[model samples]
Structures are given as structure tokens and as C-alpha cells.
Target: MSWTKVVAITGCDSGLGWAIAARAAREGLVTIAGMYNGSDTEAARALKNLCAHPYKLDVTDSKSVTEFQNYVKNVLQENPKYKLYAVVNNAGVMTVGNYEWQTPQMIENMINVNLLGAMRVVSSFLPELRKNGAINDFKPRIINVASHCGLQALPCFGPYSASKAGLLAWTRALHLEHFRDGLSVISFIPGGFIGSSNLTMNQVENGNKMLSHLTEEQKSIYEKRIRTLNKYLGQASNNTRYDSLSNEVIIETFVKALIDNKPKQVYKVEPWRYKFYYNLLKMPFPDIMYYWIIKKFLAFPDSE
Candidate 1:
């Protein structure tokens, strides 16, 4: 009795989503990848000849989500003999702004696509997962893609960090709920910025556009905040680089988590760390307190 796993993933338009779907298909899983940009996205085009199926889905839209859910249900139902193993909640967006500087729409977009989207996908797909539990080989699982920023308080990247924090909390709570029901939940947290991914440049670009629409006083405040963020993100860029191993390595972890006889509750790795810098963040002390105090000094001591 051979085993075949069918999988569904979101955010296949690029980055980790593209890498995960491509690797899963390469490893012989039936992979259905959801992309907001439909099949014509560059990420979809690159993987079009690959074994994965790129379906159009905007996680923020209830109608589109419902349609994709139906598509997955039909595919799984019509092939009842196969096991539906994993769904990777990988779709998300990032926004950079001081709380006072951010617009209502920007806040809503970040919260919707990053936090709400994950829950929406999980809620939509659970019935199909629950249906597979009776089969001997069936082991349904959910993997939420979170970030190290979720664990730490990043200075300038507030919305992204908050979203990941929400995801981490959600993953932890949901794991408890589904553990006894024959389902597995894992949170995959990747540390540091990886190359070959969208660098939140869209948010920066949008901020610049919005600057023209603001009143003179509002524009002045936004410009200063934007400069602060631009400098920080630029500095971080010099430290992070992604090699093929970063993508392959993370995907390999995903594959192992999917099939492991005893999968881990959480997977955390920094593909480019020369030392345990992330560990240093966990250091109890005035070490972190002093660092933040100095960072605040550099950022805006006058405001204090």
C-alpha cells in the first residue's frame, strides 16, 4: 500500500510559497498553489511546467476563498483514495510605519492578509482534513509560516512583527485544539531576511505616493518616519543573502515535517547566521534594555 499526499498552499505568487510548492511537487506530492495574481504571475510562470497546479486565490476575498475551497474539495473528494496531508498558510504582506503615521487602510491591509488570511484558509479547509481522519494512512496537518520577528520586538517593522505574533499565538492555541483529533500543527519560523523574496518595497513605494496626498504638516511627519525606516531596512539588506540552500533547506524541513513519524511542534532556523545572534536577543538583562535605550536614542531621543 503506497502512500500519496495531496497538499494545498497559499502565496505561490513568489518567495517561500513558490519554493515550497515547487519542492513539494518535485517530491511527488499533488500540490495545489494559490496565487492572487492568477496563473500569469512571474512566480506561476516559472513553475508552470513544474508539477504544481497554480490556482488563482486572493486570501482577502471571501468569494475567492470559497471558490478555491470548492476546488480543493472537489479534487480531494473525486480522489477519495488519496490522503490530503498539508496546507501551508504562506500568503502575507508587510507594512512599515509609525502607529501614528499609518493610515487606516494600511493597518487593515496588513492585518487582513497576514493574520486574518491564515485563519480563513484554515477554517475553510478543516472539514476536508477532518474527513480524511478515518483512513489508516491519513494524517492531516497544518503548517503556519511565521517569523522570528514574531518572537522579538523589531524596532521599525511593527505591522509585520505583530502579524507574525498573532500567527504564533493562533498556531499554538489551535495546535492544542486539534492534537487529539488526529491532526498535527506546526509553526515554521524562519529567522533573518532571505533573498529571492519581495522586500516590502511596495509598502515603501506606496508611502511615497501617499506623501503627495498628505497635508504639509502630515507630510513632514511622514517623511521623517519614512527616512528612519528606509535606513533600517537598507542596513538589514547588507546582512541577509539567500542561497539555493536557504530555499531548499526550508522546503526540506517542510517535507520532513509533513512526513515525519514524530514531527516537531516548531521549526526555527536562521539560514545566514554566523553566530547565534537570535539567541543574543533572548538574553535576559539590561543587555537588551541598554540596546533598546541606545536604539531609541538613535531613533528619536528628542521625542522622549
Candidate 2:
């Protein structure tokens, strides 16, 4: 078992995944970029141009996970020197809506992709990691690209929040459960991103479709809040120019997660307000104070 530094990053076809892979490649770590959309995206083309190896991976499918694992294993065997240094579970789907209005499929898809899909990939690649891999590199890491929704739930983003909350717990458990095995699971909490960059449009479209099934009476009860939430989402989607957002912050965070001697248990890419909210939520305050302020700005009204 030889030790070589290599990192596997999933969801590399777009968003921060692509950026992370590109950064990893530039930093001289043998990078494996995983993409679900085979040969069809502009992001795919960009990823292929980097110092990385692109592979087809569908984390939602066990067969696809196994095949990707086998392929990587073969490549490592052929080299006889390189080993997987880190596994990053970055592929996730989001669904935002009133909890009651969310269809079963919507709820299931969110949980399955964001939670179980990552579990499949991590479990599938464990043996390779254990075989003189990142443990030898001195900092073995299993990272989950979680979200702020996990820590702080908004009103209408129930499904997405639920999924991420589960991921947060899952990461915490893995961090403790696999420590003796020399595995460190880091939870990355990215702020709400909406636009051509991340996955907001798909989530919005699917949420609307699912809500269409609601009866007129059911819709009436939540329609005002739904529209308000949509308005809020539109505003958020337009705020891509957030002061704190940058290639450097995201890429560096990724590098630290994979290569830093001591990585933070929770790497949050949010501004000071989020930190404030997190702290505020822990306080035993009345509804007229911090909680009320949050609902006014961060959340849409929800029907009881």
C-alpha cells in the first residue's frame, strides 16, 4: 500500500464543486472530478481542462457508485503509488416549500439525494481510503457539503432544511464514529445560493410543480405565504453579489477541508449575520425580539 495524495470531489460539473476541483488541481493534488451529467454541460468542459481526471458518477445509484469506485481503484492500482486522500460528498438537491405542501416525491428526492446519496458514495469508497490512503497523508477527511439550512431552518424551506439537518447530524456522527479509524468528517455549511451557478431554479420549478397538486382550499390557506416566499427567493437569487462571496473563500475552504493539518468541524461560508443568527437562536428570547426579526427578513409567513 503506497501513499500518494489524491482527492475525489463529487458534483464537479457545476457550482462550488467545479471551483473546488479546479482549485485542487491547480494546487497539485491529483484530483478526481465526479460528474453526473455526462458530456453535456459547459461546466463539464471547463472541468476537463483542469489538472484533474473527470469520471461519471451518479451518487443516487448504487451501481454507479460501485462502478466509479472500481474505476478509481483500477487507476490507483495501475499507478501503484497514488491513494485517495479525501472523499468530498458535494452533490445535493434542494427543495424549498411549506412542509405540508411538499409532495412525497419532493420530500423523498431531497432526502435521498442530499442525505442517502452521499452515504452511498462515502460507504462505497471507505475501503480504498483505509488502504494506506489519507491516513498516511496525515489528515484523512470525509466532507459533506451541507448548508446553513441545517443549523437554522426558515419557514418555507422545510424540506431542504430537513435534509440538511439530517446531513449535519450524519456528519457529526461520522466524525465521532470513525475517529479511531482515522477518518474526519467535516460539515461545510454554504449559504443559500440561487442562480445559474447553484441549484435554485431546479428547486423552485420542482417545488411549484409539487404544489400544483394541492386542492384549491389547501392552496388558499398557504397561497399568500407561498407567493411571499417566491418573492423572497427571487430576491435571494439576485443577491449573488453578496459581499462575502468569492472564488478565494470557497476554494480555500475546500483546500483546508482536504489538506489542512487541522480542519474546522464546521466550515461555514456565510457572513457575519449568519453567525449572529446562530448565536441569537441559542438565546432564550421572546417572540418580539430576535425570532421576530428573523421571520421578517429571512423567512416567509407560513400557515399554521
Candidate 3:
């Protein structure tokens, strides 16, 4: 009996995750989509229409992940030819603010969903993925959807950057640890698709919550800047032109990463401008110069 390949993806409610699942299904792979909003959502319905399996999954909750794992196991049992091939950790959330403005819960939530959440899903399915790879004579891959923020920290993205950086580090470690077992792990950086994704959907509300927790002195110091930042985020999140191009490039990169015979350790999809910025950051530049360039590029408000 010939085996069919299967790929399980998290955060398929919208954006990159949904796009990847749709593409995988179109490519004749059995796609399992883990949607945080449950299987009753419009996104889930759309995925089902595309012939992908959509399940309610909350990566931050171990119980939810376990249930998802069980569901996948049942899928394999029901379809003997279906072999789990890849796990894509694409579910993430982002909130923008100064480090001082981020509450403990905000920081925790970012790390939980962006960093630890991936770990939970991988841990639950890794043994099976390894077994399938060993028996099937193929390499099982873990594609972690990281961000360029992990490579370079930008103002107002402290917690988000930290979480992504941790994820990158973990991906490297896992890859090295499991190399002999024929497991492949890589990071995929889908740069700056704010408009196409729900990542920044709560920017305004989160800004308000951040302000509510600030002391009078803190508010006086940060209120104007926070409002400016929020406005900037709102505008950036509505720039459909750039978002459309970014989505296309990112989806293309994902397709390559999924099917390439010898996949790269990191696949980054970004505009030439961001590529230039990353190159400049790599040069031996002074801290002041880096800060100045980033401030100008990001339009951060000057310190009072």
C-alpha cells in the first residue's frame, strides 16, 4: 500500500497558517489545521471546503494540544495510508509597546503562545513524527514560523522579539539534537504581513490596557508616544498593498520549504528594504547609529 503524506499546521484561523493549509491540501497532502477559534469559525469552514481537517486547538493549553494530538492519531488510524510528515508551528500573537508598558500577563501571554505553545505541539507529536520518518524512509520536518523581530529587536516589540528569539534558539537546538534521528527543523520568517494577519488585531485595545496600568508619572511620560505608536500600528495594519505582496512571497517561500529536497536552515521572505536593513544591522556599526537608523525607519517618537 502506498503511503500518503500529511502535514499538521497550527493557527489556521487566518493568515499564513490558513494559506499553508490551503496550499497543502491543493497539493494533495492531507492537511490538518489547528484553529484557535474552533472548527465552527468561517475560517475553519473554508478550510473544510478546501478538503483540509480543521480542529479546535489552543497551543497554550496542554489539554487542548493533547486533544488535538489524539484527533490526529485517530485520523492516522482511520486512514492507514496517511503518514504524518510535517508539523508547522505557525500560531502566534503580537502586541506592541515599550518594555515598561508591557504588563507581566502581557509578557507571559506572548511567550506562552509564541514560544512555549510551539514546544507543546512539537513535544506531543515528535515521537510519532520520528517513527513515521524512520519507517517511511523520509525526513520529518518541524517548520517554525518565526519573525525578523527575533533577529533584530525593534522599539515597541520587546516581548514579541524576545519570544521569537527564544523560538529560533529552540529550533536550532532541536534540529541539532535530532539530526541523527532524521528529523529536520527550520525557521521560517514571514516578515511584516500585519495587514494580512490578525496578529495586531488587538493593538488599540492592548494600548488602552497598558495605559490603564500605568502610574500618573508613567502615563505622563508615555501617553503621547503610546498614542502615536497606536496610530502608526493602525495605519500599518491597513496597508493592503504591501500586505498582499508579502503574503505572496511568504506563501511561495513556504511551498519551497515544504517540498525542497534539501531545505535551508532558515527561510526568510521579506521586501528588499527589510533585506537591506538586515544587512546594515549585520555590519560593524555603533549602537547610536543602529538606534538612530531604527528610529527613523520605524518612526518612533523621540524621547521627551
Highest TM-score, which number? 3
In model 3, which regions exceed 4 Å deviation? 238-246, 300-304
Give residue 236's error in model 1 in angstroms. Answer: 9.0
Per model, state how many residue pairs clash. 0, 0, 0
| Candidate 1 error regions (>4 Å) | 1-3, 209-225, 231-246, 271-275, 284-304
Task: For residues 1-304, write the lDDT of model 1, one tens digit per residue.
Answer: 5557889999877667777788888888888999988987666766667867788999999889999888887777788665678888989887665655666677788789988999999999887676665556577789999987788757655877888999999999988988777777889976544445655546556566556556789876567666656555444334232222245666777778767766788987665451244555566758668476536433532322
After best superposition, candidate 3 residue 94: deviation in angstroms?
A: 0.8
Would you estimate the TM-scores of all the predictions? 0.84, 0.87, 0.94
lDDT of 3 by residue, 128-225 (tens): 87776676456678999999999998877899999999999999999988877877898999887777777777788888888998999999888998
Which lDDT value does model 2 have at 151? Answer: 83
**What lDDT is reached at residue 229 by model 3?**
82
Root-mean-square deviation of every model: 4.2, 3.4, 2.3
After TM-score superposition, the amount by which residue 46's alpha carbon in candidate 2 deviates from its true location, in angstroms, is 0.9
Q: Give the TM-score of candidate 1.
A: 0.84
Cα deviation of 4, candidate 3, in Å: 0.7
